[model samples]
Target: MALEGAAAPGVAARRGLGMFVVMIGVLISAVDGTIVVLALPAIQDDLAMSLSSVTWVVVSYLLVVTVLATQVGRLGDMYGRVRMYQAGFLVFVIGSLLCALAWNAAAIIAFRIVEGVGAALIAANSGAIISELYPPAERGRAYGFNAFGWSVGSVLGVLLGGVIVTYVSWRWIFWINLPIGALALVLAVRVLRDRGERVRRRLDPVGMITLGLGLFGVLWAMTGLAAQPWGGTQLAFLLGGAAMLVAFVLIERRQAEPTLDLSLFRIPAVTPSLLASLLQGLASFAVLFLVIMYLQGPRGLSPIDASLLMLPGYVVGAAVGPFAGRLADRWGPVLPATAGLAVSAVALVVFALMTTTSSLWLPAIGNVVIMIGGSLFYPANSSAVMKASPPGRLGIASGVLRTFASIGMVFSFTTAILVAADSVPRSTAFAIFVGSTTLDGPLAVAFTDGLSTAFFTMMGVMALAAVLSAFRGRAGSPQRRPDGRAGGQVPA
Candidate 1:
């Protein structure tokens, strides 16, 4: 059997509990990631940080999580999935406490790294844990529920973040994670008791370090774009990062058991879905902060009211998720997934067109359209990737999916900051985005002008995403074997 600890007498009950814990993990990670976006201004004002430096509050978490995702998944396969997953909850709680106690830029960044480590552990293993608990026949539905966790969690983050940043201290954003994480930890320890499957493999330390540094250098260069022109320092880091990435590629080819198995891309179905997800992430994630900035900045709405406008989208997404998963199961991932991307592109266009007198409904209505697209896309793409994976490497496949998604998110975070930096003073843009301050006069008009450029650029990305999604091949088409030595039909 692919899963090792699922043979107990009350297997069904354990599976149900197993599903619950995994879902909770999804909720916690999702909420934690976005909760801080609305509070960035508060963090910057309180800490006396540069506007450019403050974006790290969001980017750092994504960067660390991106770096560790695959490595942690590999560790899960070597040790125990449930054990590592449970540990994530404990560590996340500790990190959250530290963040709440933080006094300045360095302390907050350091503590957030701790939180990101914990987040990586939870995110890397969530899919594998659920995959281990559920048989192949039921995976699509399970993934749909995972999507449910994501939608609900995002909704909670925006709503709760608004309230805390407005009334309570911004520190409460991290502090709030305490009770929620603790409860999840308690349940995870009690309910998720499976030892899970294992594979005998050595950790690829060289590959991990090289890849980590390589991505870090590139991301750091991108982050610099927010502040000033690319100088010698940026160019050096960029080149060095590229060199390290090249070395990582060479090292992986020579290894018996690589950190990232290059062969996973050999699966036709897997590659396109991975790219589609990357494009989707690139095209979407940071738009949340952009819209929030618009409402909280020039529109002069409070954070709470701004976020309230987004409530409808999340509700609709929560409603759409399960049914879309069912559709992917019945038809195939290609149609629904691609269509979702196309639909979301229209929403991006709508967002690009928001004017000074636009109704509060513009973003809210645009969000609804985008979430409907997300509800269709996320589960379908996830189902496509997991279903095509060999049982043994499911963890890595899931890790790769997460890795690509994180890479896109890192870019999204940087891209938003970079684009916004063009029209507003970097500090002011960052401050206005997080609601540390408001904008008026020519500054508001110029900021909107910058947003127009950014959104138009994003529309181009969405178009690319739609094309990639379209090329994911027919749902029932045959895909290459994971090992690349044979062929198999994609399960309908």
Candidate 2:
């Protein structure tokens, strides 16, 4: 018998199960992301790490993911999304195990790089996987559910990280992933089959190396400048990175099979949606860290307590995601997605209004508002990009999207610290960030003002994102096949 919209009975089941596996991957990734934040203090103390070294634990993962996301996504196109996705799980699991058993700062940082590679593989392919599973009209809802996984995982991460770091060892944070990763691997094997034709393109080694080195150089400079004043070393790296990136662009123009696939920008929906995602990411990701810094630094709350205040937002975001996605399906991506960015911009205004003595409810309310905006934007935006992607280019499209977002993320991390440090000593700001110290009185007020400046800057960024989202035009319609799958060529 057929299921909804003429899908075969087992086809629906397989799609459903495949999505479940994908959600698990997202969940594991989200949990790892937030869980590590709260546990950093413990990890630093145990490993006897300096603030700079401890910070690398987080930077290492993000840098690796940012550098490799596109490369791994290309691998998905060349091989199979399912196969590559499963490989991600195995790699992530092993990385987690190594991290849990890490002997020192370097060891954990190296293992985190391994974890980042796994994360890159998973993230780069997930959108392509969803696009292959569901028709264009249904992709928004699927992405909404994916957002739900992120929300739930973030909640679990905060709760579990707090409890484990306080009562148990910090190692338990990584250990928790073992069983979950194993289960996801088994389920993915049973539920996922490769769909769509794999594109066999030669890997562009020069492109990968140039892009990777360029990103590393720029990112290294940014992060270093946060801890130290502008110096020759930082300038050299920054200029060198720019030069390499220019080289990468020229190289891509020459390559028959480019790593980045510059032609994907030909799709009308692809360019704006990606820039919106990048700007929104730039404006959004740092809010969590900034808020936590405020709470822990000036408000004198513990790591767990500070994070708990944001829990309500995550819960609300999870509930709102699927609904916003459905609206995207009906009304197209521009309306809801743009509206979401506007809402987030307003939330940033509220955050900027806060002071050291402001009511705790202020940040709490702002968190809820911002999260609602995120819930609305993320799924719709993702659906737009995937829907516009040509079949053979889906993996690259997803990778490019991920690469842009990760670049924003890594930079956002550095920006938050540097911007906040403008009003206080860099060491104090760094200490508060890692939950190693707190401030009071005059220092607290100055720090709060600094955060407000950052918030206002982000608000401007979010406004730009909203404008981009508003002008993305419309994602083209694809004809549906008899089996309820999208047919016809996607418009460029």
Candidate 3:
């Protein structure tokens, strides 16, 4: 069944509020993610953390969120999306407070895990909520606004971190989230009145456990590689993680209600859109980390300034979101998504060509182009995933989409470590990544060479993604139905 009590296009005001609240939710997560990168050096100093422990501060959160995404979205399907989503805000606020007050490395990692649970809930459900709220004809527009929130939050992460960390305490970064979360939670309560219908399905404990452990093992090994070289421990973790993932696929096929409905891949739109999301995340996030490290270590820029060089991309991307979404609503996802990937490749090529003496304008211009490409790609792709999903399984579909999206990011962490370790000592590269130190002379040249290799490699990955985007068949577009309605009932 379709979600109960969804807002129609005529109710512009309520829909606007609905969009506003969710976008704010998006902003909260994005800000927290980017702001922490700037604050990591401070946290390391304050807690006297080892390099591995400091890395865990970020890795722990990503691992938890990635693991819990599908499960939480399934819960949203069974209970209520808005109810679960609101609860995420409350949990995140508490986590943020605890993190602000943490006295040691262990405490911070524990608090971050708590926060990740909340973030998982939020990320898994945001797209579903948007699908439920807006009619298919206007979903792209709503999602575009959602992208705006991400852009604004990322921009603030850089701009605010520069000012706050330089002048105020790094602890304030966590504390600042309290008010934001509180406000978002209250607004969500007021705006999200529609409750989705409950689906009667048993939780897939085996699937969840296997999938979670598989991810945890792989992600942990990747993070560990940042501090050390390939060894027995890393090999064991990688092989074990791969085995668990294989088991998850096999087990899922036998379960009546799997943690993820593997059958969803049969939908032509779903497969390509999900792949596009995954590839895009891998390419973009790796570049983001690589670029920041380059500016910070080799060029000796502050964390904020290094981040600022990429600001144009985020800002311009946000500006492009709604427009691209509108075009997707009118045309379809294939053109926009393919074009986005192609443009990103061009951006990466620009980065590959840059030199130590190159103007900051080179990076800035490339970033803006990359953002424009992403702005074009993201909303349309997300909307396409939702469009291809059946109404009854929107939550699962959204969850699966988020899972696919995050996969690239998790892999990007591995990619970042592998690439950075090639040019400099793993520890030194990691410290530079977190804004703790700088590089000079031969070391800087080596790091920049590694950066060039990574960028060119990413360009190739994006080009491949563009090909997949082009092949994602049109199945469930707004105009696809014979009755000339805004949506068609997707078959299970």
Supply the TM-score for candidate 3: 0.95
Rank by lDDT (best first): 2, 3, 1
Worst lDDT run of 10 residues, candidate 2, spans: 1-10
Give the runs in model 2 whose Cα sits over 4 Å from its true position: 1-6, 477-492
The true-versus-predicted C-alpha distance at residue 53 of model 2, in Å, is: 2.1
- Please state the error at residue 9 of candidate 3 in Å: 8.9
| The candidate that achieves the highest lDDT relative to the unseen native structure | 2
All models: lDDT? Answer: 0.81, 0.87, 0.84
Candidate 3: global Cα-lDDT? Answer: 0.84
Clashes of each: 0, 0, 0
Q: Which has the better TM-score: candidate 1, or candidate 2? A: 2
- List model 2 lDDT by residue over 1-492, tens digit each: 012352688778878888899999999999999899899999999999877678778888988887787788889988998889999999999999999999998999999999999999999998889988887778888899998898889889988988888889999999999999999999988888885687886778898889878887887787677777899999999999999999999999999978777787887888899999989989998898899889999999987788889889888988998898887766667888999999999999999998988999899899999999998999889988888887787888898899888878877887887898778987888889989999999999999999999999999999999999999856554444677554554444
Alpha carbon deviation, residue 441, candidate 3 (Å): 1.4
Write model 1 residue lDDT over 1-492, tens digit each, in one string.
134344576877777777788888888887886678878878888998777677777778888888888888878787877778888888899999999998899888888989999988898888888777765545666777888888888888888888988899999888888998999999988888655558775778898889888988877887776677769988888899999999999999998777777787887788888888888899899889889888877788888899899888988988888788766665567777888888888889889988666788899999999999988888778877877777777778777888889988888878887788789887777677767788877898889878878888888888898788788755333344455421345543
RMSD of each: 4.2, 2.9, 2.5
Candidate 1 Cα outliers beyond 4 Å, as residue runs: 1-10, 473-492
**Cα error, candidate 2, residue 368 (Å):** 0.9
Residue range 364-456, candidate 3, lDDT tens digits: 888898988888888889988988888888889998888887778878767787788878999898888878889889888888888899999
